[model samples]
Target: MALPAPNPRAMLADRGYDSDGFRQDLLIHGILPVIPSRKGRSVPQSLNQKAV
Candidate 1:
């Protein structure tokens, strides 16, 4: 059987989802991915730059 489509608010993630591509996809799908970015890497500008 095919997997069910994720809820719009559901968090979709994987280890690599820390990258920009995944984050953009989440936004496009109207989902909120709570995936924390990998350590030592700079946080995404669109997400954290304004907080600085």
Candidate 2:
């Protein structure tokens, strides 16, 4: 028998995963990625508190 595939509703990550490609890939798979922004960013990032 084959193992079942992963079907997660959402994914939670930290600022370490703050990459354009990473976010785009998650979106393509229909996974809501909740990753925070890096503090060194020039512009402030708007993050959802509830999502965290």
Candidate 3:
């Protein structure tokens, strides 16, 4: 599989990819993850639409 760009600005994903692990991975890679939070989450996550 092709690797991602050297330095991605951010990552956009659906609720399926909404998880702390995944978000942490993105941060570790220096990329911001813009994914909607799943239902029933203890703390709902807010999305910054302007950044997207």
Number of the top lDDT candidate = 3
TM-score of each: 0.56, 0.69, 0.78
Q: How accurate locally is residue 43 in candidate 2, as Cα lDDT from 0 to 100? A: 67
Selected candidate, larger TM-score, 1 vs 2: 2
lDDT (0 to 1) per candidate: 0.60, 0.76, 0.83
Candidate 2 C-alpha lDDT tens digits along 1-52: 9664488656778899987788889889987778888988786456666763
- lDDT by residue (5-40, candidate 3, tens digit) is 787888888899989998998889888888889996
Task: Give candidate 1's whole-model lDDT.
Answer: 0.60
Model 1 quality (TM-score): 0.56
Report clash pairs, candidate 1: none
- Worst window of 10 by summed lDDT in candidate 2: 43-52
Residue pairs in collision within model 2: none
Q: After superposition, how far is residue 8 of candidate 1 from its true place, in Å?
A: 3.3
